[model samples]
Target: MHHTRLFDSYICLDPSMWWDNQALLKETKRALETRRFHGTSLYLGIANTADEGMDVTRVLTDTTTATLHMRSALQLQRYFEHNQQNGLKYRGKYYQDDSHMSVPFIAEYEALRFLFGAERK
Candidate 1:
C-alpha cells in the first residue's frame, strides 16, 4: 500500500491500480495552487522486490510544492509504457492484483478524530 498524507488528507494508494496519473497530478496541482488542497502532506511507502518498505514522506507546504509537482509530472509520464513492437499499456498493473490496488482517500478531519481518540466528527 502506498500512503500519502497531505495536510489533513491521507491517501492510501496501491501502485498497481490504474488511473490517469497525469490527470490526477494535474488536478492535484491545480488544487494545490488554488489552495483547495492546502495543508496536504503525503507519505508514499514504496515496497521493493526485496520485501523491504521505503517511506517517502513529504510535507506539502509552499516550499515543497515545486519538487512535488515535478515528481508528480514524472510519475504521470511513467504510468504508461510503450513496448517497442506493441502498443501502450498501463504500468500500474502491479498494484491491481486481487482488485486491491486503489487509493483510499481519507480526510484530515477524520484522521484527527482517530488520532485524538475523539468521537467521529
Candidate 2:
C-alpha cells in the first residue's frame, strides 16, 4: 500500500508476477512518461509476499518530493504488476475480486499513517 498527503488518497494492489510482464511494464513506463496525469502527481510501489509472486502498489502524491518518491515506487510497482499471474505462471497466487485485496484498506491506512503520518489535510 502507498499513501500520499498531496492527494489524500491511498492505494493497495495484489503482489503478483504480472508486474514483470513486458507488456504491462511498457504501458506503465509510457504512463509515467506523460509526467502529469489529471493534475495529480503519481507514485507507485510493489510489495512482495511469500504467497504471491509480485504485486504493484501505487501511491499518487502531488507534491514535488512525494512525486519523486512516487516515481521510484512506480518503477517497483511496474516490475511486479506486469510479471506475475496465478496458477502455472505465478504459483501459489492469491486472488481478490473487489477493490480491496486480501489486505484491508483500514490496515493499509494504518500502515500508511505510520509510514507517512496520521494527520490528514
Candidate 3:
C-alpha cells in the first residue's frame, strides 16, 4: 500500500509513519511536492506520542525525545493537509489517546470510513 498505486485508497499507521530522522516522511513529502497524482488517495492515522498536554504546534518545535515520533507524524500530517496541489486526495487523524502499539485497529476502521466517503467524525 505504501509503494504501489494499484489501489486508490491506502492507510498508514505508526511507526511506519516515521523512520530515523524522518527519512520516509521526507521522501513522501518530496514525492507529493514534485509529482502530480490523479485518482489516488492516502489516509494517515497518526498515534499521539506527544507528551501530555502538548499540542501539535508545540510538539513540532520541541527538541526533546518525547515529542520526536509525534512531531514527525504531525509534520507529515501538516504536509498532507496544506499541499494538495498534486491532486492526491488525503486524510489524517491524530489519536490523542492511542499509542503506536494500539493505533492500527481503530485506524483501519477510520480508514475504511474515509475510503467509503463517510463523515470524518
Candidate 4:
C-alpha cells in the first residue's frame, strides 16, 4: 500500500505477525503516521487463536511467540480505529469463533462485501 496506488483496497486475514519480529506491524504504524491513503481502503480480519483464559489484555503482556500473532494484529486493529485522519477507509473485524486456520473464507467474503457495498441477505 505504501509503494503502490495500483490497488485501492487491501485485505489482510490473520497475518503472520511472527515474521521478522513483527516488522509488518511496525512498518504499518509508520506508514499510517506518515503517509496518507485518502482514496484507499484496508480491511483487517483478526482470528481468535487464544488459549484458554487468555484475553486481549492478558495476551498483550505475554512476550511468547504463540501470543505475538494475535497481539500484533490487534494492535493494528486498534491503531486503525483510533487513527482515522489519513482518510483511509479501514475496517477491522475480530472473529472470536474463528481460528487462524479458519478465517480466510469468511474474511474474504466480508471484505469483498465491504469493499463493494454488498449487503448480507
Best-performing candidate as measured by lDDT: 4
Model 2 gets an lDDT of 0.35
What is candidate 4's lDDT per residue for 1-121, written digit by digit as tens?
Answer: 4564979888989887667987878888788877788889888999998897888888789888779889888888987887798889988899988898899989999999998889576
TM-score of each candidate structure, all chains considered together: 0.27, 0.32, 0.84, 0.90
Q: Please write out the lDDT profile of model 2 over residues 31-85, one tens digit for every residue.
A: 4444233322222223322223223332333333423333343554544345332
Provide the overall lDDT of each model, using Cα atoms, as 2-decimal numbers.
Answer: 0.31, 0.35, 0.81, 0.85
Report per-prediction Cα RMSD to one decimal: 15.6, 15.0, 2.3, 1.7
Task: Give the per-residue lDDT of model 3 (tens digit) for 3-87.
Answer: 5577877778864545567788888888878887678888899887777788878988899877888888888888888789989
The model with the greater TM-score, 2 or 3, is 3
Q: Residue 115 error for model 1, in Å?
A: 6.9
Q: Which candidate, 2 or 3, would have the higher lDDT against the true structure?
A: 3
The regions of model 2 sitting more than 4 angstroms off are 1-10, 15-20, 41-45, 50-74, 78-107, 110-121
Q: Per-residue lDDT for 46 in model 2?
A: 32
lDDT of 1 by residue, 13-119 (tens): 33322246346655543433343223332333222211123122331122343334334433433322221122221122222112222223333333344434574
User: lDDT of model 3 at residue 19?
Assistant: 59
Q: Assess the local accuracy of residue 91 in candidate 1 as a C-alpha lDDT between 0 and 100.
A: 24
Candidate whose TM-score is highest: 4
Candidate 1: how many backbone clashes?
12
TM-score result, candidate 3:
0.84
Q: In model 4, which runs have C-alpha deviations exceeding 4 angstroms?
A: none
